[model samples]
Target: MASKVIQALYNDDDVLMHAVKKVRAEHHHIEEVYTPFPVHGLDKAMGLADTRIAITSFLYGCLGLTVAVVMMNYIMIEDWPQDIGGKPSFSYLENMPAFVPIMFELTVFFAAHLMVITFYLRSRMWPFKKAENPDKRTTDDHFLMEIGLHDNENELADLLWETGAVEVKVTEKES
Candidate 1:
């Protein structure tokens, strides 16, 4: 049989934080927290490590810039060089400003597409992927804290209620 997990639902992040602080002070184990929008300093309170998405985004942007420069250089200078209005084609280095538009366009294109793809993959939000939200209201106006109870489940629920939980429910793990 799967063990049950208790979730305390709150309307405000402040209330949630108070509850987390209280529970942690009492050495209760917290499983996860869900919020509709990011609550500043909540991750620190929960002792979560910093996310690496910023570094990943920077790397992806650099890749896009490199691809743009290489592709533009290859096409305009090597593959099929063309001159317009008596402008030199063999030596684009002298007219580097002319390639700026193409470079910017390609950089934006690649960075946008790749960043979106990366975010989706990292969040496990592929096309047609069903979100595992336990309550529909959680996506709108509710903040939820999921705690695991090794013992004293009833007392914990009472504490959560005292700390401003709008509702408390126990959910059994799916087998």
Candidate 2:
């Protein structure tokens, strides 16, 4: 038997939540959810775990800071030291404030760029990636509930309609 995808569209958040609750109560498997804007508490309702990107971002920021400091110190002090304005430039530890701007910039730069790249990679998003969504209307103005079905397609469709779905459609794989 092949797996099938059934999508239920809803215009109201409360209706969507109610449908999700009903679907879960019936022990049906929900594959994924798509929304145009953030829905508060929807993740909890969908039983999704919290994202740990914040921790990753912090670690990446620290790495950036370390790189900036080490590179700057090596270039200005060890590799090619230059006496500027008659001041000793052998050790930057005494005047770390001079490097604060660069450090901050690098930290922010790394955190933002790396975090975005990580997020995109983790989410399976890349350049030239074709769309995986089943319904294009869901992206514009509707909430979608993607449910996997093993059998009993008509029964599931009726349940979804009774649960206040505006429309229901079935999506089959290409192969």
Candidate 3:
């Protein structure tokens, strides 16, 4: 069976937020939303699950810290010890001050870079990928909300219009 969606266009973020609340209150299923800027509390309004990506970032940082510790210990204490500033690189604990900067830098680098890669993969935002934006205006100044249509075209369109949608249109969705 073919699917359908109702696209609602709003000029302002406030109106879009209001419309989302109204649609959700009426038990309508919203499929997606596009906004030029992030709308505060939109996810909560949409009833979306809280993201779990922060846990991955913490793990990535731990991996980087572990790598830095092992690498520094091997290079300075075991592989080739150096004597500089009257302090020999003979013990990791004794020369801990010198390794602090490298450890901090590596932890931050791993967290930031790995988090970005994970986000890109999770969102499928690969380089040169075609955008799924329904309208060009949505990328600029307009906000768009796509609601799943379940034999409620007229009812949903009327509700959207009442909620201050500038335009409402129904279209077939590809499986």
- Which model scores highest in lDDT? 3
On TM-score, the leading prediction is: 3
Per residue, candidate 3 scores C-alpha lDDT tens digits across 49-134 of: 99989999999999999999999999988999998677768788988898999999999999999999999999989999999888
Candidate 2: stretches off by over 4 Å = 84-87
Per residue, candidate 1 scores C-alpha lDDT tens digits across 1-175 of 7777899999998888888888888888788898999988888888778988777777777887788788878888888888866778887685478888877777777778888888889888988888777788889999999888777889989988998999999988653
RMSD of each: 2.3, 2.2, 1.4
Estimate every model's Cα lDDT from 0 to 1: 0.84, 0.87, 0.92
lDDT of 3 at 23: 92
Which 10-residue window in model 2 sums to the lowest lDDT?
86-95
- lDDT for 142 in candidate 3 is 97
Task: Note the residue pairs that clash in candidate 1.
Answer: none
Please provide TM-scores, in order, for all candidate models, with all chains considered together: 0.84, 0.87, 0.95
Model 1 misplaced regions, further than 4 Å: none
User: On residues 1-175, what C-alpha lDDT tens digit does candidate 2 reach at each position?
Assistant: 4567898899888888988888888888888887767788888888888999999999999999999999889998889988776657878885476779999999999999999999999999999999887778767888999888788789899999999999998887452
- By TM-score, the better pick of 1 and 3 is 3
Looking at model 1, report the run of 10 residues with the lowest lDDT sum: 86-95
